[model samples]
Target chain A: MRLWLPPVLLAVLLCGLSAGMPALEPLFHWVQPDKQQVIYERESFLFLLQNHLLLVLISAAVGTLVAVAGGIFATRPSGRDFLPLVSQVASIGQTFPPVAVLALAVPVLGFGEAPILVALMLYGLLPILRNTLAGLEGISPAVKEAARGMGMSPLQVLVRAELPLAGRVILAGIRTSVTINIATAAIGSTIGARTLGDPVIAGLVNGNTAYVLQGAILIGLLALATDSLFEALERTWDRRFSPQVAV
Target chain B: MSVSRSESSQLMPNRVIPALGLLALALVWLLDVGTIQPNRIVPGTGHGLVSAVGWGGAALVTSTLAGSILLAFLNLRGRYLIQLALLGLSLALLPLLLDVFASRHLPEDSPFARSSIGAGFWCLLFFLFLMLIETLGRLGSRRGLELLLVVVIGGSWLIFLQSEGLESLSLVREFNARPAKFEQAFWTHLALAFGAVAISAVLAFGLALKMMRSPGWQRPILGLVSFLQTIPSLAVFGLLIAPLSALVAAFPVLETLGIRGIGWTPALLALVAYSLLPMVRNTFVALTEVPENLADAGRGMGMNERQLFFKLKLPLALPVIIEGVRITTIQAIGLTAVAALIGAGGFGSFIFQGLGQAAMDLVLLGALPTIALALLADAVFTMLAASLKPTPATA
Candidate 1:
């Protein structure tokens, strides 16, 4: 229960801040004294927040499924021949800057949510795939052999033994993937995706510090909320799975 | 031995390379290989492989793919070596194919007319590179061979891109328009990315030392740095604006020193902040993970603590520390591009400006170099780390 507290509090703060941004106009006026309209009015902070979350959520779901499946395939005996290339691709793909990937998508797919979605999915999968490989490969051959000796089939052993053992690291990979997707989704606003970055980009263009601050605070809070949620999850996983290990 | 030989032979016909070959063959004919534009803003006419570069070029591409696929079925000794040579040659000369496309399809009369790479060309280049990686891995090639390949191919592309035939390529045209700005962006990007890495390396070293001396300090410092990293780059840049502008307002002297609210200052701060997690974590682990016996041996030699650190521990830790630097440098290069949003003036300025104007080639002009810089940094630092590692027997 205590482990869950931080994430809950952070989520509440994120929601409160997003909904209450307009009420703080007097404060924003002080931040930007010369501007006639200090508050960002083109889009509501809540709607932008929702859109940003939807983009990240959809990409994260699809990226996880694809990356995990790819990792499993590469590790299996049937797909063993491709493991080297797959791992190489996973690591090398990360060297690409996410912003460059996002930019490149615009030329090929044009400006819209679709391009950003594809970019997020592709970029987000790399880290997850790398971690999935690392996690699954880190398991010892002896463990699998023992499971086989116990008369369990390969599919049964994989589902019952291998995946459970690798789940913690896979969760860590998901955490990393989500964190990056959040940041990239914010930048997606520049490519015509409606996101929290809308206010920040608009503020930068118009030289309105208030709008910038509002967007920045919300983005910062969203990231914090998401990170803390992952922290609580990792702690729960650790406690439930590895009670013998010290924190 | 006989059973193992049989099993290995059964696995002989490599499936990955042939599959990639088939995909490339399809894409090269199915998709546009290049596009010819009359001007910067308008959409261009798409050209297939034969239309863009003639049947000769088309035959050359088809033959390369067909040959790579055919070689996989040969079951001959040293097959991977032959495949490597063939693919490496093809990859090294890929830019000339584009040059051919530009020379053939580009309108000679219109100064504004330019040609850009299309999906098929990108697919061909990508599939060829994948095949090369597979072949290299199968051959268990030496690091020297890989480096030689990179240098040869990179040099070839540089020469071809700068050649007269490709002058009408849209990416080249964009660079030609603002050569001075391109140079400045290059320098600014190098300075900002490396500057942040250097600063954080020193600060993280100090922090790591402190954590080593007092274990209680470790959690709080790591926590703060990771927290800084979790915030999006734009938000960090945005968050820094208010306080920085207010500070400059309060201290007018900072304006003359070029410390603004939204330029390189905030960018440097944010980059340095983000760099700390990897830098400190690696430094701390590297220093602490040094074997205890080595230090005792140094003490047995009557060396003081400082001498033991400088002579024994630091040298052992250097490779891991350099590994951390590699990660930080690649990350900083990417973030520096994002920092352009806050007026830091790097390659990202070109990306954003191009996006604003809907100029795809200009965006490539920014993005391609950033990716190249990252790949270069990755290669250099990887080599440096490998070279710094003490051999197992010696250690």
Candidate 2:
């Protein structure tokens, strides 16, 4: 019998069967209806989870568009000189601390979700940008020239000729951005953006180790799950679309 | 050479137009800030003709820039717009540096305190104008200019944070400030972590060199390092605590040798351990790709293995090794921020402080510096890697 360790464990983590989401609220809260004292509800937990996921998806989608376009730009002759510039810019995005990025952008964008989205997008850009550049550069010039000589449009060459060849490397970029985004999304929750980090942050403050564990494990599991899933998708994509790609 | 100079000179006017455009925009912001009534707290102002001018000017500048960028894309214009932007930014920062960082350090109510805005504009504008001129000037290398800009930006901030920086400068001050908890707290944790990575870099370099020469040892060691990286950084820290604690118990000397704890020591050691795989693997790859025929030629010349490793392989491998270092340093910076989770502190002092207080501003104070540190480290690495490559003149 074949045993699948990663899938089995990942499933358990996601199901919150073996490990559960963490507690976020203080031990007591004043109820909205009767002013009676109570703990925070399950509703806040759900809100955090939903917002966290939304931030991740939006950031990653923005990242993909920018990276792919950047990749294409990097492949052009004049843009070739911009590799260092683009890399440096992305690193700045990486370097401009997320909190600082929030501070810097706050005057421009204001509080809450917008700043968080900006942070994740900035952080998410580098790997995707770098990978896109690297992937496109790695494509054989001869193959590209051949595509052009055959009367194929530039778009056609990029889509059918160059991208297909660079799929694996591009996928690697996607993987890096996705994983980084997962960790960074937690930082957003700190700014009232509601994320699984609510529990973790709450737990740490109150010295409630259990609450911390609940948040930490779920977030960790989330990262691991994305990592594994993307990795699988990468492998599958490579096998199907570019059969000749070296594993 | 003569032809190249002529070609570059032809590129001069391409630089000038955009630079002028940026200056014009800066003038507009200046007018806006000067003439507009201030809300003080809100940037870009809340109302009045100045506010209108402030935003209007900003929109116009953005469009001009976008236009310039579009021209570059279309190969019609603005190829030099970017150069001008960096130029303006760098120049503006120099004076702004005086204002932002130096202001509060002065007597609290001094009019000179707000004069930082003047300093800000002067320095920043100078840098911008200089850069635009430089592209036309080719007066200095772009890389040098970029470094100067970063230094101007970061150095000014450092000057601003001297109080905090000086406080954390010494282990003696740090330890004496808290006797019993010396080994467990934030400052010690950061120092240990910083030390761990530095030590690990040296150790990993040696280990990598050894494994590169020996097939039997390389595979297992690489596997171990890769596996180590896969462990959640926190989990690794957790796993390490028990082993470290056990080792300290079994061999008491290890404790006095400066081994210990759920604190900085273990956290740092674990981070270093995580760091090694990338450095070692990168070093190995760099060394191995030195084209075996070069080593064969060295052997034919009767050079000893040691000489060949250093004189040829190491120099050839320097770029990749430095690239690895770049990655390691950034990773270390990020991970170091997490060191706060284990009670070890760098700038994570601000991060946790912000979290506990739920004050986002406080967290930015900590995190911004960490990000700056990471970026600065990346810049340093990039420069090192770039310098290692065979220069065009040499080639």
lDDT of 1 by residue, A161-181 (tens): 788888899999999999989
Candidate 2: which stretches are off by over 4 Å?
A1-9, A16-54, A73-87, A95-113, A241-247, B1-193, B206-210, B213-224, B227-263, B355-361, B386-395
Q: CA lDDT of B104 in candidate 2? A: 24
Model-by-model lDDT, in order?
A: 0.92, 0.59
Note the DockQ of each predicted structure. Answer: 0.86, 0.21
Docking quality level of the chain pair in candidate 2:
incorrect
Report the C-alpha displacement of residue A210, candidate 2, in angstroms.
3.3
Query: Once superposed on the true structure, which residue ranges of model 1 sit more than 4 Å away at CA?
Result: A244-247, B1-11, B392-395
Local error of candidate 2 at B241, Å?
7.2
TM-score per prediction, in order, is 0.97, 0.70
In terms of TM-score, how similar is model 1 to the real structure? Answer: 0.97
Alpha-carbon RMSD, each predicted model: 2.4, 8.6
